[model samples]
Target: MIVAATPADYADRPLYAPIAPMLRRFPDGLPDLATLQRLLEASAPQAVSGGGRPVRFVPPDDALPAYEARIHASGEVPTRAGDWHDFFNALAWCVWPLAKSACNALHVRELAAREAAGLPGRGSRRDALTQFDECGIVVVTTDAEIPALLAAHAWEAVFWQRRAALRETTRFLVFGHGSWDQLRQPFFGLCAKAIHRVVDPAWLRLPAAERQTETDAWLAAQLAATLPTLTPRAFSPLPLLGIPGVTPDSEQADYYRDTRQFRPRRA
Candidate 1:
């Protein structure tokens, strides 16, 4: 029977499947921006060295410069922060607070260093890191060889031929909602490739209790030095099957098979 599906049928599709596991941490699933705001308001103030500040969500009306300044000064990632673009950022922080803190702290230091050095403005590294913090992918791997393959853009080897190895060796942690949305309706030609930072696999092998501490230390070290370099590796064809919970047929796959976006590097 070729019955047409309705909107209600598609409603079951998860909006942000990449973070479905992390979303479970909330117990209450992902809350809307308004609901998230009320919850933050109800929470107790964060204890600071000099007393504490009551935690509150940054209103959508706040100017961007002001919001950035507040976070930079306070070293706090606001809950339900910013608008639709950054709502996923709040969720990311909830999922990986240590990592998010490490990222923010690094950015602040980079900005300060630039000011101290009398650099004209933001450095390339800072801009790159900021792009990463806004919408980056952390590819944590157990094997040393995987990173090289990733850097080389060996999509087939890393994602297909050695697919089983990927499940065992790599962990993809997505941070930005922009990244999340792209994963949902991926298009090879869109040029929306994520910023990739590969975490050493050895860190993951540590005891669960020590993993966060070790990872935080690693992040801090990387920040103190150079931020990870980003490269574009948009899939030649969107890897729909590779994505969890996405079961697109050939027709659906055709959507991302556009030659404009998926043009081969070799003529």
Candidate 2:
């Protein structure tokens, strides 16, 4: 049984490192909808959803349209009070507004296409998008070989053999808010769908905030261009625990040998 985490647990884990700055604002508990909206307005005044509506968090409304549609149409994110999932999602909007907006746009576009085509269900593109939204990690690197190793599922080779290089040349940024929620009580088999971006090594040297800004811009452009062609297969699977420093067990080379989490790639 998953015990929902409280604000007190926010700073206790490395998994929350990415969003620590934002999480610090509400140390007592989850922020209410008004607080979230104020944060959005202050932090990302220009932030808007796909349909150009200004992004604002509001209480959940059953009478509204579907979640994505509502966001696209009205930019109102239906946030459940005190819900960790919704809280992190709100943080994602503040941190990666461009990419998040692009994602919302793509979702609206895909849904419209499906309706026009008389499709009965959400198609593969939407499925891929949701998977990424819920559990995606963006692996930014200067080295192409590193992504190749990840794609090959060469856990030992990538996380152990080239560990130093991996640290120097690559950065793993968690993009999925659901993954953030899961990381509150991280488990062995927690894997994330990964998308790779090859960036200049110099870009990696910038401060965290600057790097995130660039990443948001680049990712938004990438998604705007390729979302139509994206499939779940386009992502590489990454065992979060296998990353160096994510867990104490990962310090030793033997940790990568656990096939349960580091399954070998099928031929």
Q: What lDDT is reached at residue 229 by model 2?
A: 84
Predictions in order: lDDT: 0.47, 0.86
lDDT of 2 by residue, 49-156 (tens): 989999989899899899999999998988899888898899889888998899999999999999999998888898898899889889999999988899999999
Quality of model 1 by C-alpha lDDT: 0.47
lDDT of 1 at 252: 42
Q: List, residue by residue over 9-119, the lDDT tens digit for candidate 1.
A: 222343343345334434433456655544334321221111122223454445444344456565344544334345556555444445555555556666677789998
- Highest TM-score scorer: 2
**For model 2, what is the error of residue 267's alpha carbon versus the real structure, in angstroms, after optimal superposition?**
1.3
Where does the lowest 10-residue lDDT sum fall in candidate 2? 1-10
